[model samples]
Target: MSSHEKLSAAANDRKARLAQLKSLKRKQAPTSDEADAAPSPPAHQAEISDAIVRTEEEGEAPSVATTYLSGRNYDPTTRNVKLGFDNLPIADPTNTLEYKAQQLALETKAQQEAENKEDNGLDLFKLQPKKPNWDLKRDLEQKMKSLDVQTENAIAKLVRERVEAQKVIRQKKPADGEGEEVGMEGSELVEAMHLKEQEEARDRRRDEEDEDGIYRAKVRIGTAFTLALHEAISDRGPCDILESVNIRSNPSVRSKTRWKSVARAWI
Candidate 1:
C-alpha cells in the first residue's frame, strides 16, 4: 500500500479506540445524583485519593508510602527514636570483633618492629661497631709499638742468657786445669789445645761483634737512632759498647747508667 493510505488507516484505528474508551467511561461513571447521594469515604481514604489525583494531574508519579506519610504528619521519633548518643543502635563500634582484630594486627606489627629494633641493637652479628679510619690507625700504631717493645725485650733476654752462659764457661776454665796438665803430656796435644782456645776466643769475639751489629741495625730508628748508635760505638777505640761499659763487672748498674745518660741527653 501507499504511505498516505497506511497513515490514514493508523489514524482511524486510534480514533476508534478513543471512542470505545469514552463509551466505556460513560457506562461505568456514576450519575450526578448517585455521586451526591453515595456514602462518603473515610477521611483518611479521601485524603489519599485527593493526593494521588493531584500528583496525576500535575504529571508526576505517585510518591511512595513513606514519602506520602512524610508529606503529611510524620514523626520519626515515635517508633525508632534516637534519645541521645548513648541510645544509638551501634554505639561502640570499637568493641566489634572486626575492629578488635584490626587493632590486634596493628599492635602485633608494632611489637614485631620494636622487637626487631631491640634485637638489632643487641645482636652480635648486627651490632658491629664502625670505627673511624683514625681510630683504626691509632690502634694499629699502638699494636706496632707494643710489638716493638716485646721484640726488644726478647732480644735483650737472649743476650743476657748468652752472656750468663759465657760467664759460666769462663768460670769452669779454672776447674779444668788439673785435667789440662794430665792431658797436655805431649807437645802436639798442648799446641792443639792452645790453638783450639785461641780459635774459640776469636769465634766468641766474632759472635759478639755480629750480635752487637745486628742489635744496632735493628733498633736504630726514630728516637732510638742516637741511643743505639752511641751504645754500639765504644769509648776506648770505637769498638764494642759492652766491653767499654765493662758489662762483665756489673751489667745491671751499667744498663741503669745508660738509661740515665739517655734521659740526660733528652733533658
Candidate 2:
C-alpha cells in the first residue's frame, strides 16, 4: 500500500486501543453506591497506600520495601550461644528386648577384641649397630696377620736347611796338603756358589736396613730440634739465637747426636 494509507491505518488502530483501555478503567473504578457499602481499610493503611501511589507518580527516585513480615530482633553486641545436650540419654527405647540384645552383642564384641590383643613378642627397640668405614681394615687385619706368620715360618725353614747344607760342606772339605785328588762335585760347587750368593744378598739387605734406620733417626732428630729451637728463640733476638745455634751445632756434635739417636732406634 502507499505510505499515506499505512499512516492512516496505524492512527486508527491506536485510537481503537485507547478507547478499549478507557472502557476497562471505567469498569474497574468503584461506583459511588458500592464505595459506601464496602468496608473501608484502617486510616493508617489508607495513608500508606496513598504514599506508595504518590512515590510511584514522582520521577525523583525508586521506592523500596518499608515493611517486613520477618525482622531481626537481636542486639548487635550479643552472642548467640547454643546450649549443649550431650548428657541427655539417647531417644531409643531402652527397655525393649531388641535393645537389650543389641547392647549385649556390642559388649561381647568389645571383650573379644580386647582378648585377641595379646603380646606378639617382637622387640622394636633392639636395633643392630651400624658398621663403620674402618670395618674393612678390621676384616683384613686377621688375614694379613696369618700371611705374615706363614712368611716368617717359611724363611726360618729355609735358613735351617741352609745351615745343614753348610755343615755338610765343611765336614767334607779336603785338607790342603793331602796328595789325594778328592775334589768337590759339580752339584756341590753349584750349591756352594748359590749359598754364597744368598749370604751376599742378605748382607746387602741388612746394610740397606741400617742405612734407612740411620736416615730416619736423623730426620726425626732434626725436626724435633728445629721445633724446639723455634719455640726457644720466640722471645730472643734473632742474631743471638743464630750465633748460639752456629756455635753449638758443630759437625762433630751433630754426628755424635745422630749416632745416639740411631742407637736408640735400634734398641
Candidate 3:
C-alpha cells in the first residue's frame, strides 16, 4: 500500500478507538446524581417509616406545663418569681390587700349606685300637689239629681202602664150574676163561651173514649185466660163482662196488676 493511504488508515483506527472509549465512559458513569436531580423526597414523608414504630414500651413525650402568669417577664419591684405566676404554689391569691381594696371599691360603688336608684324610685313616689281641678263630688251630685228625675219619669211611665192594664182586666172581668146572660146573647162574648163549651165537651168525650178503650182492652186480655174474672163499672157506662177468666188462676197476674197500678200513679 502507499504511505499516504497507510497513514490515513492509522488515523482512522485511532479515531475509532477514541470514540469507543468515550462511549464506555458514558455507560459506566454513576446514576446517583441523575436520580437526585430528578426529584427530591417530600418533607412530610417519614424518614424511616417501616424501620421505626411508636409503641407503649417506649417512653412518652414530656407533658407541657400550664401557667397563668399575666406579666411578660419577672418584675423585681413586685418580687415576683421568674417562673410563671400560674405555676407558683399559691392558693386564694385574692387575699392580697390590693385585691381586697379593689373588691371593696367595686362594692362601695355598687352600693352608691343602688342608693341612687332607690332615691330616684322614692322621688317617683313623692306626692306632688294636685292642680285645683273641677269638683267631682258636685258634678256627681248634679248627675245624681238628673238621674233621679229620669228614674221618676220611668217609674211614672211604669205605673201608668200598670194602671191601664188593671183597667183592662177590670173591664174584661164578668159580673157575678152576668155569666148566664152573657152566654144567652149572640154577640162575640157568647160565641167565645160557646167555643169554650165545645172544647170542654170534646175533652170530656175523649176522656170517656179513653176509659172505654181501657176497659175493652182489659176485658180482651182477661178473655185470653180461662179462670180470671174482669169487671169494669164506670159512672157513665155499664159494666164490662169477662168471657173467660184465666188471670184469677195465674198468681203472676196480681204482680202485673200491682206494676200497672204503680205505673198509673207515676203517669
Candidate 4:
C-alpha cells in the first residue's frame, strides 16, 4: 500500500476504537433517567455533585451550577454563586478582622493621647545645666562667705594704714616745722569722715524712696564709721569727748583697751 493510504487507514482505526470505548462507557454508566428511577446513597450523591462542579469549573463555557436537577427536586439555594471581593465592602460576621482593626485604632489613639499629654512631651527632671538644689545653695553660700571675709580684710587693712598715719602725725615734733602738716592732715581726715557719714545718710534716705524697696546702706555706713572711730581711738588714746562717745556706743572698746594695757604691763 502507498504511505498516504496506510496513514488514512490508521486514522480510521483510531476513530473506530474511540467510538467503541465511548459506547461501552455510556452503557456501563447510569443516565439521568436511571438515576431518577433509583436513589443514590447520600455520600455517593455528594461526591457526584462535587465532581460535576469541578468539571464545570474547568470547562470553557462556564456554568454557575452544573448539578443535574431532573433526578431530585431543584433547590435554588443549592446553586453555586460567583463571589468576588472586587465590588463588595470587606466584612466578617466572626468579628476577627473588625476586632483587629478596632484594636489598631485604639492603639493609635492611645499613642496620640500619650503624646498630647504635657508630661510625656517634656522631661522636667532632666533640665539643662543640672545641679542639685542643696549643692547649688551650698556653693553659693560658700562664695558669699568668702567674698565677705575678703571685703572685711581689705577694710581692716585700710583702717590699720590710717591708724599708722595718725600715729606718725602725733609722734612728729612741732619744732620740726611739721605742726601745720599735722593739723592739715587731721582736719582733712575729720572732714572726710563727716562727709562720708553725711553721704551714707543721704544714700540710706534715697534707698527708702527708691521703688526697689531695698534698705541696707544705713547699717553698713554706721558699722564703717564705728570701725573708723575704733581705729582712731587705738591710735590717739581715746582722750576726747568723741572718743568717750565711741566707747559708750561700742563697749567692746573697753575690753580691747584692757587687753592692750595688760600686754604693755607684761612688756
Highest TM-score scorer: 1
lDDT of 1 by residue, 1-267 (tens): 999999688667745744554464458778899989999789775666666556655877554442236433444446343444545477798989989999999999999999988876456775775433447558777888989899779867966775676567657777656455444435544675798799879977976776678667666543464664455443233333334344435556665456534433433
- All candidates: CA RMSD in angstroms? 31.3, 34.2, 39.6, 30.7
Question: Model 4, stretches more than 4 Å misplaced?
Answer: 1-152, 162-175, 211-267
Which structure among the candidates has the greatest lDDT? 1
Query: C-alpha displacement of 68 in model 1, angstroms?
Result: 12
Better of 1 and 2 by TM-score: 1
* lDDT (C-alpha) at residue 196 in model 4: 78
Q: State how far residue 169 of model 2 sits from its true place (Å).
A: 17
Span of 10 residues, lowest total lDDT, candidate 4: 62-71
Clashing pairs in 2: none
Q: On residues 1-267, what C-alpha lDDT tens digit does candidate 2 reach at each position?
A: 999999688667745744554464458778899999999889865654555444545743222222211113422233333345435465667987888999999999998888777534556697665433247557777788999899779867976786677567666875552232223334555786798799879977976776678779889988876655454545445544434444344566665444433333322
- TM-scores of the models, in the given order? 0.23, 0.20, 0.17, 0.19
Number of clashing residue pairs, candidate 4: 0
C-alpha lDDT values of all predictions: 0.61, 0.59, 0.53, 0.60
Residue 13 shift from truth in candidate 4, angstroms: 99
Tens digit of per-residue lDDT, candidate 3, span 64-101: 11112323575545655566555646577897887999
**Backbone clash tally for model 3?**
8
TM-score of candidate 4 on Cα atoms, chains taken together: 0.19
Off by over 4 Å in 2: 1-186, 234-267
